[model samples]
Target: MEEGICYLTLNRPQRLNAMDPSLLEGLLEGLQGAAAEGARVVAIEGVGRAFSAGADLVEFYRA
Candidate 1:
């Protein structure tokens, strides 16, 4: 990884690290950081079996 590279790992393993608003914000922050740092790469990883389930429907269902 580049020194300027940014990464955000979704720590939700049982739930497949589904994307939430917080995760979105984190991603945005990472993107901004990478851009600000003039990074050539930004990577996102999940601790679970999937990179992401796209979004968490259960969380959305509450809203």
Candidate 2:
């Protein structure tokens, strides 16, 4: 958390960090962490060209 606020980031770049089942768990964790710590606010960001592609084509192909 930053400034007593929660900051969560998507770590997938190759696929624009698309949200899969795993992402939900991590996001839930972040919110839970912030809530547990009594955070004043929550923020989300991306570390790639786009916020998210919504889904991962690479993984789909791979699977």
Candidate 3:
């Protein structure tokens, strides 16, 4: 927490931080946790070149 802000970093730089089910779940949980912890602001960042490549189509197509 920095200056009442919470930062959530997407860790999968190898895949350009693709949004798989696990990642989505973790994001949701992280947001909830941040809110519960009384964070005034939330910041989402990604590692590597892209912030996100959006949803993982491989996982989507598999469903």
Candidate 4:
């Protein structure tokens, strides 16, 4: 933890941090890691302007 805070950042700025299966899985993994590391607080942040546009519609369309 940095300065007593655990930060989880979304790295897909090009896609407005859209939620994909991999990203979602990574988030869960990060959260689990934070807990395992005894982090008191976990903060989720986005790299770019938008936090997220929501789930990626392209994946839905493909299926």
Candidate 5:
């Protein structure tokens, strides 16, 4: 958090920042934290070639 701006980064570059349960949970937690901290802006970013692969197909298939 910097100057009321919250930065949420997806760190699963190995998996192209896939949207899995854990990632989703972390994002939700970050949002809540940002709100609690009175953040005026929330920025979501991914650390990889793709912002997101949409979803984890392998995990989805296993479920």
Candidate 6:
């Protein structure tokens, strides 16, 4: 968080930032934190080749 801007980074580069339960939870937490801190903007980004590869099929199957 900086200058009222909250940055939520998806750091699962190995899996192309797949949306797993943990990651989703983290994002939700980040959003809540940003709101609590009065952030005017929330910027979500990824840390690797792609922003997101969608859901994690392997993890989904394991569930």
RMSD of each: 1.9, 2.6, 0.9, 1.4, 1.0, 0.9
- Candidates sorted by TM-score, best first: 6, 3, 5, 4, 2, 1
Full-model lDDT for every candidate = 0.78, 0.81, 0.94, 0.89, 0.93, 0.95
Q: What is the per-residue lDDT of model 4 for residues 1-63, given as tens digits with 9 covering 90 to 100?
A: 886578999999999999988889999999999988888899999989999889988976776
Name the weakest run of 10 consecutive residues (lDDT summed) in model 6. 54-63
Query: What would you estimate as the lDDT of candidate 4?
Result: 0.89
TM-scores, each model vs. reference = 0.76, 0.77, 0.91, 0.86, 0.89, 0.92
User: TM-score: which is higher, 4 or 6?
Assistant: 6
Instruction: List the candidate numbers ranked by lDDT, top first.
Output: 6, 3, 5, 4, 2, 1
Residue-by-residue lDDT tens digits, candidate 6, 12-59: 999999999899899999999999999999999999899999999998
The true-versus-predicted C-alpha distance at residue 13 of model 3, in Å, is 1.2
1-63, model 3: which lDDT tens digit per residue? Answer: 878899999998888999999999999999999999899999999999999999989988897
Worst 10 residues of 2 by lDDT: 54-63
lDDT: worst 10-residue window of model 1: 1-10
Mind sharing the TM-score for model 1? 0.76
Clash count (model 5, backbone only): 0
Candidate 6: C-alpha RMSD after superposition: 0.9
Candidate 4 accuracy as TM-score? 0.86
- Which wins on TM-score, candidate 1 or candidate 4? 4
Better of 2 and 3 by lDDT: 3
Enumerate residue pairs that collide in model 2. 12-17
Off by over 4 Å in 3: none
